[model samples]
Target chain A: MTEFIPPGTRFHPLPSPFPMKRGGALVGAHVAFETWGELNAARDNAVLIVTGLSPDAHAAANEGNPEAGWWEPMLGPGKPIDTDRWFVVCVNSLGSCKGSTGPASMNPSTGALYRLDFPDLSVEDGADAAASVVRGLGITRLACLIGNSMGGMTALSLLQRHPGIAHAHINISGAPRALPFSIAIRSLQREAIRLDPNWNHGQYDEVTYPESGMRMARKLGVITYRSALEWDGRFGRVRLESDRPDEEPFGLEFQVESYLEGHARRFVRRFDPNCYLYLSRSMDWFDLGPDGLRQIHVDKVLAIGVHTDILFPLQQQQEIADGLREGGADATFLPLESPQGHDAFLVDIARFGPAVAGFLATL
Target chain B: MTEFIPPGTRFHPLPSPFPMKRGGALVGAHVAFETWGELNAARDNAVLIVTGLSPDAHAAANEGNPEAGWWEPMLGPGKPIDTDRWFVVCVNSLGSCKGSTGPASMNPSTGALYRLDFPDLSVEDGADAAASVVRGLGITRLACLIGNSMGGMTALSLLQRHPGIAHAHINISGAPRALPFSIAIRSLQREAIRLDPNWNHGQYDEVTYPESGMRMARKLGVITYRSALEWDGRFGRVRLESDRPDEEPFGLEFQVESYLEGHARRFVRRFDPNCYLYLSRSMDWFDLGPDGLRQIHVDKVLAIGVHTDILFPLQQQQEIADGLREGGADATFLPLESPQGHDAFLVDIARFGPAVAGFLATL
Candidate 1:
């Protein structure tokens, strides 16, 4: 299983066994993953982790940072997704530039960045691609397939669409199908990117990406990721008069604007425009098996809901558990409380770690 | 009394006791006013009611649309200022256009409007102008001088700089000195107007008013005037989508935007641009009496504070009362609850009117 991989070692790229095609998009995987511990002989000791969107395969921690992956606190040596026990492998999803086949990678067909012509893709393709990695890596079974947010939807797809895959699924703060509000918000983000003049119909090959468009998208996304109360409490009426100290015009507004701008700027640099759109659209279009969950074939499931997660509220988690139960799968549910809103799944480690650790401990 | 001028009745030439000034850039006025009530022959039965910013000489529900000086509910027959009880004179303070001298009036020095060239008007100047009108109208004494918000500050200025010209003073939600937060907010509003491309340094004439800039200014003002909770409760995530039904596009968000737009549109039509800028600046620079109540001047003070007045909290009202008491004046304090906030004097007429009536009855 994946536990055979060294603990301190990170990037674990599993090349595809064969080529993959979806719609007009042809892709071959060079799946980069971050594995914890060693893969057992039967692979039953293995748990597969997947990141949502934008982040790289480094799902555990950076060499120096030691705390990244949006959910680093929940995955560590003694914590949940315990590196000391279960072999965990988190591979960057397909159609992402984080050491995976993506728009930024040269299209084998045109020998250029895929850009808009990369052809539309869905979450099913992402799940299939991930499954291919497990098979190519010689893992016949996964102990648990873990995913959060968009990644959670992919996990569900993997269990139902790909048979004899993972034995158990852990969905943390996600939905079987995208909420209408989520769809609308994502649509707006895409529109904002499309409206940027520099986007050039996704054609400008001068290497100057549509940073403005990306920044706007990030700003729009961050708004939903944060709570209004948090914004009011943190930056209510603060006017940083001398912020741009060197700049002549000292009239600055609330520091919150600067904070938001920072998030927008940073996100634009490390993320690909097309990948974000594709992932968001994938999340938007996601739904369950043929007839609700009865059609899906997962052996067991553990759904983790968070109270303050407006994006994937408690109802979404409950629906997942209910659907799995209806499908004759052993399902459990856990709810966590955190004011960090949707980001709470990534930040509420004190409660989430215990819940994750206890759940995995049983396995 | 203004009551003599019935509703729908327009005063010819608007009684410009304070001539309109057109100093090169704009034309504005210093309007005059009078009320219709029994003078009691002694003239001591007269009370001069004053307004803060933007209001003209018209105070009563005059014979016009019954909505004139923004304090119509408190000035009608048998109301607080009680047109039936006392002779009331509320003049359009100087540096205002409703028959008062301001940037919109023709400059005596030049043939054009004073416009940007209009000297930075002080609240003290506005108060002195009102005092001039009281003297011009041959009123020997005022039974009481009632002011609200900036009007309250203006009243305080009148009582402080001017001697015992008025016997009783009623200041509602007023501050003798402006708060730093208030100043900062006002500064931002002014900056928005000044930054407008069409503003031309505040010299746009030919009826091509800086409507857009003025709208933004009013929008900023409205945001600050009402509590944000009210915004979320009322507008929240409601959108004014494109006219086409079944349009999947996500359009304008937050009902507050539409709310602000509606308000700004109305204000842009009714109010002058320079007047708003000048009034805001005047408020920013406002200060009355000495450092504390120990140096203020007033005989008897009735200070009213509205609970929802976030801009000028209830404590500011308390400060007004305390200052009067320190100045050896008899002081009375009362709090009125209204969701209308700083604009409660205009909106919560039922509650506000009765409170004013009760206070006036005692006075």
Candidate 2:
């Protein structure tokens, strides 16, 4: 049976060439994970956590790490994720950092990093690898699968690919399908990265790895993710001294611009550029309408969203619930109010905790 | 005595190197006009039409030319700015094209193209110059000064600088001071031009000017001048394909984008880039309450605004009226319903015309 590891806990690797879904000719995955608490008698006391685009297996609370799994507050001993009562599993999806196989992993064919040679990654590959990790941990069934944003996408894919694994779902701030605006925004990011001369077509041994492109992506992405009111509130036209104050372009500028540009630069330093592209593509192709969701059958679902988000906003969540209802699943729509925008689900844990707790109480 | 010109139009020259306030310099300007009906026996039958940012001498009717001045219907013999009763005179402001002296004009001091060397302009300068032109035309008092956007700003500055001009004021969709958000957005356009390699630090000759920078500036300007709701209504992600399909560098993106960019490029060709910079700055620095609202006296005011404008929005118009009221001026605030956003005054002439006509009747 699956076990749950509490906050500040550690886990050992359950290593395997997990046979990644990219035709097996070019890509394979090494799956690993950790669990919290012991499985109940029915082995249905397990919950899986799908994380943001760059989240990893140390989804546990690590002290002093702000970038730790976005849901740190909800996953503690008696918190909503409730490691004390439920066996919880979190797997780093394919084409990511941490334990799962990714672009940085060695290609058996070339005996080198997959790099640009990494096959086009699909959400299915990540889903397949996640299921492998689940079954490997002896988790035969889940009480619920909770996903936020990109993580929510993987959770939805899980229902289609594995019918009986998860008993229920809670998708927050995500869509059953990718919208065109989302695709267009992603295309711009991809272009930003691809256009950089320093990228050297993704072969650069240097650490730069298209920082400007990543900055552009983050700048544009941040705009989509937040509401216009949020922007005005956060960084209107307040000015500060310029970084290059002595230079010719010396002058004060809007504080919002500096905040956005800084966020982009910071992302490039800690993240692998290839991982962002691969993961973003996974998100772009995540549409349940055509083939993915039509094949999936969930027993019950709870799709939640916040009002201020423009990214995977409330409308998209409604679409997910509607799509699930069309697929003959019992689905519910929950619209939460918060000003934190697309990141509200992660930031507003106090409000979200009750929603998850209430759903779990019903179970 | 100044002679009354005919209703269609008349060309007139304001005295050169006009008088200036202390620490103020004159930007070169020439006056153009169109009148309706006859001048009064005292040579006092005159109202002034303070045209918006991008209009010319032809204020009232799209006569022989398909494109007349922006406020065509609102400014004619019988319209709100009644050319018949009041000897209506409209003059192109200094630092503008359409026959006014700007960067494209040869520098009288150096006998060379001023280009970047054009004296930094301000709202005080525009108003002061307009006053000089009217004074030179032998009209000591204006029956009313009606303006929109920058023209509204010019009216406010005229009230601040030369409070002796006849008191009736019509300021549509503008503010007494530039909001910080306005400053930031306009700065982006300036930077796009200033940073362009071809701009050569604003020294580029007319024939080899930075077309790309101009296009980018215009594109940015279009966003501020209109709303996204209007954009979706008009374009809705519609691509504008040129005859050269599969053109290099993905030529001509969305129709709306292309339309604005094309307009911008052409605008820079005819208009002066330096003038754009100067004019935007002039709008930013407008403030009647540097000391206090009561200190600056402005009486007899009609403040009209559109709901869709994010630039110099209705909220600011309300503030302007509030300021005028506190300063002992008769203030009226009116919100015009139009989908045209900031350019509503110029775009929806039918709706704008009647409101203007009614207001001018009272004036």
TM-score of chain B of each: 0.85, 0.86
Report the C-alpha lDDT of model 2 over B143-199, residue by residue, as the tens digit. 677777888888777777777686577788877766655665565556556645577
Give the Å shift of residue A311 in candidate 2: 5.4
Model 2: DockQ vs. true structure: 0.12
In model 1, which regions exceed 4 Å deviation?
A1-363, B1-31, B34-36, B63-69, B206-208, B228-256, B326-329
Q: Write the per-residue lDDT of candidate 1 for residues A202-288, one digit (tens) a residue.
A: 665436677766775686566556544345456654545763432412123346545666788778867777767777766655777
Going through the candidates in order, what fraction of the true interface contacts does each contain? 0.00, 0.03
Q: State the lDDT of candidate 1 residue by residue for B222-294, as single tens digits.
A: 7546653344345544545743232322223334445665677777756666767777767756765366455
lDDT of 2 at A318: 88
Q: After superposition, how far is residue A137 of candidate 1 from its true place, in Å?
A: 16
* Model 2 bad stretches (over 4 Å): A1-26, A29-60, A63-217, A220-238, A241-250, A254-261, A264-363, B1-106, B111-158, B162-184, B205-217, B231-314, B321-358
Model 1 lDDT vs. the true structure?
A: 0.66
